[model samples]
Target: MKLLRNILFTSTLLMSAFAAGTAANADPGRFMDMKKSVKAPIGHKQFCQDNGWACPRESYDPVVVQLNEELWQQLIAVNAEVNRRVKPMTDNDLFGKEEHWSYPVNGYGDCEEYVLEKQRVLMEAGWPKSALLITVAKDVQNSGHAVLTVRTDHGDMILDNQIEAVLPWYSTPYRYIKRQSASSPVAWTGIADTRVTTVSSVSR
Candidate 1:
Protein backbone atom coordinates (compact mmCIF):
# COMPACT_ATOMS: atom_id res chain seq x y z
CA MET A 1 0.00 0.00 0.00
CA LYS A 2 2.85 2.45 0.75
CA LEU A 3 4.54 1.74 -2.61
CA LEU A 4 1.25 2.20 -4.45
CA ARG A 5 0.66 5.56 -2.75
CA ASN A 6 4.16 6.71 -3.64
CA ILE A 7 3.66 5.77 -7.28
CA LEU A 8 0.33 7.67 -7.37
CA PHE A 9 1.95 10.72 -5.89
CA THR A 10 4.75 10.62 -8.46
CA SER A 11 2.24 10.28 -11.27
CA THR A 12 0.27 13.26 -9.95
CA LEU A 13 3.41 15.35 -9.80
CA LEU A 14 4.36 14.50 -13.37
CA MET A 15 0.90 15.33 -14.64
CA SER A 16 0.90 18.59 -12.76
CA ALA A 17 4.22 19.56 -14.27
CA PHE A 18 3.00 18.77 -17.74
CA ALA A 19 -0.13 20.81 -17.22
CA ALA A 20 1.84 23.77 -16.01
CA GLY A 21 4.15 23.64 -19.00
CA THR A 22 1.27 23.44 -21.38
CA ALA A 23 -0.45 26.38 -19.75
CA ALA A 24 2.69 28.44 -19.90
CA ASN A 25 3.17 27.87 -23.63
CA ALA A 26 -0.48 27.97 -24.57
CA ASP A 27 -1.50 30.37 -27.32
CA PRO A 28 1.99 31.09 -28.47
CA GLY A 29 0.59 32.78 -31.55
CA ARG A 30 -2.36 34.41 -29.90
CA PHE A 31 -3.31 37.72 -31.47
CA MET A 32 -4.67 40.91 -30.07
CA ASP A 33 -8.42 41.25 -29.71
CA MET A 34 -9.25 44.03 -32.12
CA LYS A 35 -12.50 45.91 -32.54
CA LYS A 36 -14.13 47.28 -35.65
CA SER A 37 -12.15 49.02 -38.33
CA VAL A 38 -11.34 52.66 -37.76
CA LYS A 39 -10.32 55.51 -39.94
CA ALA A 40 -6.64 55.72 -40.65
CA PRO A 41 -4.88 58.62 -39.02
CA ILE A 42 -4.70 61.80 -41.10
CA GLY A 43 -0.94 61.76 -41.06
CA HIS A 44 -0.84 58.18 -42.30
CA LYS A 45 -3.37 58.91 -44.99
CA GLN A 46 -1.31 61.81 -46.20
CA PHE A 47 1.79 59.70 -46.01
CA CYS A 48 0.24 57.11 -48.29
CA GLN A 49 -0.67 59.80 -50.78
CA ASP A 50 2.77 61.38 -50.78
CA ASN A 51 4.61 58.07 -50.89
CA GLY A 52 2.37 56.11 -53.18
CA TRP A 53 4.91 53.40 -53.74
CA ALA A 54 5.05 52.55 -50.07
CA CYS A 55 1.31 52.08 -49.67
CA PRO A 56 -0.25 49.02 -51.22
CA ARG A 57 -4.03 48.66 -51.00
CA GLU A 58 -4.55 44.99 -51.76
CA SER A 59 -5.83 42.37 -49.41
CA TYR A 60 -3.67 39.34 -48.76
CA ASP A 61 -3.18 36.54 -46.28
CA PRO A 62 -1.96 37.98 -43.02
CA VAL A 63 1.19 36.35 -41.75
CA VAL A 64 2.23 35.51 -38.22
CA VAL A 65 5.91 34.71 -38.22
CA GLN A 66 6.99 31.71 -36.22
CA LEU A 67 9.24 33.14 -33.57
CA ASN A 68 12.50 31.47 -32.61
CA GLU A 69 15.71 32.44 -30.94
CA GLU A 70 17.15 33.73 -34.21
CA LEU A 71 14.09 35.76 -35.07
CA TRP A 72 13.88 37.22 -31.58
CA GLN A 73 17.54 38.17 -31.73
CA GLN A 74 16.96 39.82 -35.09
CA LEU A 75 14.14 41.87 -33.68
CA ILE A 76 16.31 42.97 -30.77
CA ALA A 77 19.17 43.87 -33.06
CA VAL A 78 17.03 45.86 -35.46
CA ASN A 79 15.18 47.71 -32.76
CA ALA A 80 18.38 48.66 -30.97
CA GLU A 81 20.18 49.60 -34.16
CA VAL A 82 17.43 51.90 -35.36
CA ASN A 83 16.86 53.47 -31.99
CA ARG A 84 20.54 54.25 -31.85
CA ARG A 85 20.79 55.49 -35.43
CA VAL A 86 17.88 57.94 -35.56
CA LYS A 87 17.84 61.17 -33.61
CA PRO A 88 14.40 62.05 -32.29
CA MET A 89 12.84 65.37 -33.28
CA THR A 90 9.27 66.54 -33.32
CA ASP A 91 7.37 66.86 -36.56
CA ASN A 92 7.35 70.61 -36.19
CA ASP A 93 11.10 70.71 -35.80
CA LEU A 94 11.71 68.40 -38.73
CA PHE A 95 8.97 69.45 -41.13
CA GLY A 96 7.63 72.74 -39.78
CA LYS A 97 4.23 71.10 -39.38
CA GLU A 98 2.20 69.91 -36.46
CA GLU A 99 2.19 66.33 -37.79
CA HIS A 100 4.13 64.79 -40.60
CA TRP A 101 4.86 61.11 -41.22
CA SER A 102 7.75 60.24 -43.46
CA TYR A 103 11.09 58.52 -43.53
CA PRO A 104 13.94 60.21 -41.74
CA VAL A 105 15.51 62.49 -44.31
CA ASN A 106 18.80 63.22 -42.60
CA GLY A 107 19.00 60.65 -39.78
CA TYR A 108 16.43 62.75 -37.91
CA GLY A 109 12.69 62.22 -37.56
CA ASP A 110 9.76 61.84 -35.20
CA CYS A 111 8.30 58.69 -33.75
CA GLU A 112 6.28 57.84 -36.83
CA GLU A 113 9.26 58.30 -39.08
CA TYR A 114 11.21 55.77 -37.07
CA VAL A 115 8.32 53.36 -37.49
CA LEU A 116 8.35 53.96 -41.21
CA GLU A 117 12.04 53.24 -41.54
CA LYS A 118 11.80 50.12 -39.43
CA GLN A 119 8.91 48.85 -41.49
CA ARG A 120 10.82 49.53 -44.66
CA VAL A 121 13.92 47.74 -43.46
CA LEU A 122 11.95 44.72 -42.28
CA MET A 123 9.91 44.49 -45.45
CA GLU A 124 13.04 44.77 -47.54
CA ALA A 125 14.50 41.90 -45.57
CA GLY A 126 11.58 39.73 -46.81
CA TRP A 127 9.33 40.06 -43.82
CA PRO A 128 5.80 40.00 -45.16
CA LYS A 129 4.02 43.32 -45.36
CA SER A 130 1.06 41.81 -43.59
CA ALA A 131 3.05 40.97 -40.49
CA LEU A 132 4.47 44.46 -40.08
CA LEU A 133 2.00 47.14 -38.92
CA ILE A 134 2.22 50.80 -38.04
CA THR A 135 0.63 51.38 -34.66
CA VAL A 136 -0.52 54.57 -32.95
CA ALA A 137 -0.79 54.98 -29.23
CA LYS A 138 -0.85 57.45 -26.39
CA ASP A 139 2.45 57.49 -24.57
CA VAL A 140 3.00 57.61 -20.83
CA GLN A 141 2.55 61.36 -21.05
CA ASN A 142 -0.81 60.88 -22.78
CA SER A 143 0.72 62.28 -25.92
CA GLY A 144 0.47 60.67 -29.34
CA HIS A 145 3.21 58.32 -30.47
CA ALA A 146 3.86 55.66 -33.10
CA VAL A 147 5.53 52.27 -33.05
CA LEU A 148 5.98 49.30 -35.31
CA THR A 149 4.13 46.10 -34.38
CA VAL A 150 5.50 42.79 -35.58
CA ARG A 151 3.14 39.83 -35.67
CA THR A 152 4.79 36.62 -34.55
CA ASP A 153 4.11 33.23 -33.08
CA HIS A 154 5.12 34.59 -29.70
CA GLY A 155 2.50 37.33 -30.01
CA ASP A 156 2.69 40.91 -31.17
CA MET A 157 6.01 42.58 -30.45
CA ILE A 158 6.67 46.30 -30.49
CA LEU A 159 9.69 48.05 -31.95
CA ASP A 160 9.87 51.63 -30.79
CA ASN A 161 12.32 54.42 -31.34
CA GLN A 162 11.95 55.67 -27.79
CA ILE A 163 12.62 52.21 -26.39
CA GLU A 164 15.78 50.26 -26.97
CA ALA A 165 14.39 46.85 -26.10
CA VAL A 166 11.77 45.13 -28.25
CA LEU A 167 8.85 44.12 -26.09
CA PRO A 168 5.59 42.28 -26.34
CA TRP A 169 2.72 44.61 -27.11
CA TYR A 170 0.99 44.07 -23.79
CA SER A 171 4.15 44.94 -21.88
CA THR A 172 4.34 48.45 -23.32
CA PRO A 173 3.13 51.39 -21.29
CA TYR A 174 1.32 53.11 -24.16
CA ARG A 175 -2.39 52.91 -24.66
CA TYR A 176 -2.84 51.42 -28.06
CA ILE A 177 -5.26 53.26 -30.31
CA LYS A 178 -5.17 51.71 -33.76
CA ARG A 179 -2.90 50.03 -36.26
CA GLN A 180 -2.65 49.13 -39.91
CA SER A 181 -4.78 46.22 -40.89
CA ALA A 182 -3.03 42.90 -41.33
CA SER A 183 -4.91 42.20 -44.53
CA SER A 184 -4.25 45.51 -46.23
CA PRO A 185 -1.75 48.23 -45.62
CA VAL A 186 -4.22 50.96 -46.44
CA ALA A 187 -6.76 49.91 -43.85
CA TRP A 188 -6.71 50.44 -40.10
CA THR A 189 -8.18 48.55 -37.16
CA GLY A 190 -8.95 49.79 -33.68
CA ILE A 191 -7.40 48.07 -30.69
CA ALA A 192 -9.71 47.21 -27.84
CA ASP A 193 -7.51 48.39 -25.02
CA THR A 194 -9.43 48.07 -21.77
CA ARG A 195 -7.20 50.65 -20.17
CA VAL A 196 -8.55 53.36 -22.43
CA THR A 197 -11.63 55.05 -20.99
CA THR A 198 -12.18 57.14 -24.09
CA VAL A 199 -11.17 56.56 -27.65
CA SER A 200 -8.94 59.56 -27.78
CA SER A 201 -7.59 60.82 -31.07
CA VAL A 202 -3.93 60.27 -31.87
CA SER A 203 -1.78 62.74 -33.82
CA ARG A 204 1.38 60.75 -34.68
Candidate 2:
Protein backbone atom coordinates (compact mmCIF):
# COMPACT_ATOMS: atom_id res chain seq x y z
CA MET A 1 0.00 0.00 0.00
CA LYS A 2 2.74 2.44 0.92
CA LEU A 3 4.72 1.66 -2.18
CA LEU A 4 1.66 2.05 -4.38
CA ARG A 5 0.81 5.35 -2.77
CA ASN A 6 4.38 6.62 -3.20
CA ILE A 7 4.36 5.81 -6.89
CA LEU A 8 0.92 7.26 -7.41
CA PHE A 9 1.43 10.47 -5.46
CA THR A 10 5.03 11.45 -6.16
CA SER A 11 4.49 13.13 -9.53
CA THR A 12 1.38 14.88 -8.31
CA LEU A 13 3.10 16.16 -5.22
CA LEU A 14 6.06 17.39 -7.21
CA MET A 15 3.84 19.42 -9.51
CA SER A 16 1.87 20.91 -6.64
CA ALA A 17 4.97 21.84 -4.66
CA PHE A 18 6.52 23.49 -7.70
CA ALA A 19 3.33 25.37 -8.52
CA ALA A 20 3.21 26.66 -4.95
CA GLY A 21 6.98 27.37 -4.92
CA THR A 22 6.97 26.27 -1.33
CA ALA A 23 9.71 24.61 0.74
CA ALA A 24 17.84 20.43 14.76
CA ASN A 25 19.43 20.91 18.08
CA ALA A 26 21.11 19.04 20.99
CA ASP A 27 21.06 16.80 18.01
CA PRO A 28 23.32 19.64 16.96
CA GLY A 29 25.61 18.58 19.76
CA ARG A 30 26.17 15.08 18.44
CA PHE A 31 26.44 16.39 14.91
CA MET A 32 29.06 18.77 16.19
CA ASP A 33 30.90 15.91 17.90
CA MET A 34 30.52 13.83 14.76
CA LYS A 35 31.46 10.35 15.92
CA LYS A 36 32.94 7.75 13.61
CA SER A 37 30.27 5.58 12.05
CA VAL A 38 30.28 2.05 10.62
CA LYS A 39 32.09 1.44 7.39
CA ALA A 40 30.42 3.31 4.58
CA PRO A 41 27.76 1.20 2.91
CA ILE A 42 29.41 -1.06 0.34
CA GLY A 43 27.05 0.10 -2.36
CA HIS A 44 28.12 3.73 -1.81
CA LYS A 45 31.75 2.80 -2.28
CA GLN A 46 31.05 1.13 -5.59
CA PHE A 47 28.87 3.98 -6.76
CA CYS A 48 31.76 6.38 -6.19
CA GLN A 49 34.08 4.21 -8.26
CA ASP A 50 31.63 3.60 -11.06
CA ASN A 51 30.60 7.24 -11.09
CA GLY A 52 34.21 8.40 -10.87
CA TRP A 53 33.62 10.43 -7.70
CA ALA A 54 36.83 12.14 -6.58
CA CYS A 55 37.05 9.58 -3.78
CA PRO A 56 38.55 9.92 -0.27
CA ARG A 57 35.83 12.37 0.64
CA GLU A 58 37.02 15.78 1.76
CA SER A 59 36.15 17.81 4.90
CA TYR A 60 37.11 15.84 7.97
CA ASP A 61 35.08 18.43 9.92
CA PRO A 62 31.35 18.45 10.51
CA VAL A 63 29.50 21.45 9.10
CA VAL A 64 26.86 22.50 11.61
CA VAL A 65 24.36 25.25 10.89
CA GLN A 66 20.70 26.03 10.39
CA LEU A 67 20.83 26.91 6.73
CA ASN A 68 19.26 30.29 6.18
CA GLU A 69 16.02 30.59 4.24
CA GLU A 70 17.72 31.48 0.98
CA LEU A 71 20.03 28.49 1.23
CA TRP A 72 17.09 26.28 2.15
CA GLN A 73 15.30 27.30 -1.00
CA GLN A 74 18.34 26.51 -3.08
CA LEU A 75 18.62 23.07 -1.57
CA ILE A 76 14.94 22.41 -2.11
CA ALA A 77 15.14 23.47 -5.74
CA VAL A 78 17.97 21.08 -6.50
CA ASN A 79 16.48 18.20 -4.55
CA ALA A 80 13.17 18.50 -6.32
CA GLU A 81 14.82 18.94 -9.70
CA VAL A 82 16.97 15.83 -9.44
CA ASN A 83 14.17 13.82 -7.94
CA ARG A 84 12.04 14.88 -10.85
CA ARG A 85 14.65 14.27 -13.53
CA VAL A 86 16.00 10.90 -12.45
CA LYS A 87 13.81 7.88 -12.99
CA PRO A 88 14.33 5.09 -10.50
CA MET A 89 15.59 1.90 -12.10
CA THR A 90 17.26 -0.76 -10.03
CA ASP A 91 20.82 -1.92 -10.66
CA ASN A 92 19.54 -5.16 -12.11
CA ASP A 93 17.39 -3.27 -14.56
CA LEU A 94 20.13 -0.78 -15.48
CA PHE A 95 23.31 -2.81 -15.13
CA GLY A 96 22.16 -6.44 -14.87
CA LYS A 97 23.89 -6.75 -11.53
CA GLU A 98 22.30 -6.65 -8.09
CA GLU A 99 23.51 -4.15 -5.48
CA HIS A 100 25.40 -2.01 -7.96
CA TRP A 101 25.32 1.76 -7.27
CA SER A 102 26.42 4.43 -9.74
CA TYR A 103 25.79 7.84 -11.15
CA PRO A 104 22.66 8.24 -13.15
CA VAL A 105 25.00 9.00 -16.03
CA ASN A 106 21.93 8.73 -18.20
CA GLY A 107 19.58 9.86 -15.41
CA TYR A 108 18.40 6.27 -14.86
CA GLY A 109 19.71 5.00 -11.55
CA ASP A 110 18.48 3.76 -8.22
CA CYS A 111 18.12 5.40 -4.81
CA GLU A 112 21.77 5.75 -3.88
CA GLU A 113 22.60 7.26 -7.20
CA TYR A 114 19.84 9.76 -6.75
CA VAL A 115 21.46 10.70 -3.47
CA LEU A 116 24.94 11.02 -4.93
CA GLU A 117 23.71 13.36 -7.61
CA LYS A 118 21.84 15.48 -5.14
CA GLN A 119 24.87 15.79 -2.92
CA ARG A 120 27.06 16.54 -5.87
CA VAL A 121 24.78 19.26 -7.16
CA LEU A 122 24.33 20.73 -3.71
CA MET A 123 28.05 20.97 -3.29
CA GLU A 124 28.38 22.44 -6.73
CA ALA A 125 25.74 24.97 -5.86
CA GLY A 126 28.33 26.31 -3.43
CA TRP A 127 26.75 24.78 -0.36
CA PRO A 128 29.24 23.58 2.16
CA LYS A 129 30.32 20.02 1.47
CA SER A 130 30.54 19.05 5.12
CA ALA A 131 26.89 19.74 5.91
CA LEU A 132 25.47 17.88 2.94
CA LEU A 133 25.61 14.17 3.82
CA ILE A 134 24.74 11.11 1.79
CA THR A 135 22.69 9.06 4.23
CA VAL A 136 21.20 5.57 4.35
CA ALA A 137 17.86 4.62 5.83
CA LYS A 138 15.38 1.74 5.91
CA ASP A 139 12.46 2.30 3.58
CA VAL A 140 8.90 1.24 4.31
CA GLN A 141 9.85 -2.17 2.98
CA ASN A 142 12.77 -2.34 5.42
CA SER A 143 15.19 -2.32 2.53
CA GLY A 144 18.24 -0.11 2.72
CA HIS A 145 17.69 3.23 0.99
CA ALA A 146 19.81 6.28 0.51
CA VAL A 147 18.96 9.93 1.17
CA LEU A 148 20.72 13.24 1.51
CA THR A 149 20.46 14.47 5.11
CA VAL A 150 21.18 18.16 5.66
CA ARG A 151 22.24 19.10 9.18
CA THR A 152 21.22 22.34 10.76
CA ASP A 153 20.96 24.20 14.03
CA HIS A 154 17.48 22.82 14.73
CA GLY A 155 18.03 19.23 13.62
CA ASP A 156 18.21 17.37 10.32
CA MET A 157 16.22 17.80 7.15
CA ILE A 158 15.89 14.90 4.71
CA LEU A 159 16.08 15.26 0.93
CA ASP A 160 14.83 11.98 -0.43
CA ASN A 161 14.25 10.62 -3.93
CA GLN A 162 11.19 8.62 -2.94
CA ILE A 163 9.15 11.67 -1.92
CA GLU A 164 9.28 15.11 -3.49
CA ALA A 165 8.26 16.64 -0.20
CA VAL A 166 11.38 17.30 1.81
CA LEU A 167 10.71 16.20 5.39
CA PRO A 168 12.16 16.98 8.72
CA TRP A 169 14.03 13.97 9.96
CA TYR A 170 11.48 13.40 12.69
CA SER A 171 8.54 13.64 10.28
CA THR A 172 9.86 11.24 7.66
CA PRO A 173 8.26 7.79 7.44
CA TYR A 174 11.35 5.63 7.23
CA ARG A 175 12.96 3.97 10.20
CA TYR A 176 16.07 5.95 11.01
CA ILE A 177 19.28 3.99 11.01
CA LYS A 178 22.70 5.42 10.15
CA ARG A 179 24.18 7.90 7.73
CA GLN A 180 27.48 9.33 6.63
CA SER A 181 29.12 11.12 9.49
CA ALA A 182 28.86 14.88 9.12
CA SER A 183 32.61 15.07 9.66
CA SER A 184 33.47 12.82 6.76
CA PRO A 185 31.02 11.96 3.99
CA VAL A 186 32.65 8.55 3.67
CA ALA A 187 32.21 7.15 7.20
CA TRP A 188 28.67 6.42 8.39
CA THR A 189 27.25 6.32 11.90
CA GLY A 190 24.36 4.64 13.66
CA ILE A 191 21.92 7.54 13.92
CA ALA A 192 20.76 7.79 17.47
CA ASP A 193 17.01 7.28 17.73
CA THR A 194 16.94 10.43 19.84
CA ARG A 195 15.03 12.61 17.37
CA VAL A 196 12.06 10.31 16.99
CA THR A 197 12.09 9.15 20.57
CA THR A 198 11.88 12.68 21.92
CA VAL A 199 9.25 13.79 19.44
CA SER A 200 7.07 10.79 20.28
CA SER A 201 7.38 11.46 23.96
CA VAL A 202 6.34 15.06 23.53
CA SER A 203 3.35 14.13 21.42
CA ARG A 204 2.10 11.67 23.99
lDDT of 1 at 104: 88
C-alpha lDDT of all candidate models, in order: 0.79, 0.65
lDDT of 1 at 105: 74
Per-residue lDDT of 135-182 in model 2, one digit per residue for the tens? 766655556778888877645767898877765564455555667766
Alpha-carbon lDDT of model 1: 0.79
List of clashing residue pairs for candidate 2: 24-154, 24-155, 24-156, 25-28, 25-154, 37-188, 66-153
Model 2 bad stretches (over 4 Å): 1-36, 51-53, 57-59, 194-204
lDDT for 64 in candidate 1 is 95
Lowest lDDT sum, 10 consecutive residues, model 2, at: 195-204
What does the lDDT come to for candidate 2?
0.65
| Per-model TM against the reference | 0.82, 0.74
- Every model's Cα RMSD, please? 10.2, 9.7
Write the residue-wise lDDT of candidate 1 on 67-178 in tens digits. Answer: 7666767777878888888898998888999998999879999898899999998888888999999999987677898999999876788899876767666555667889
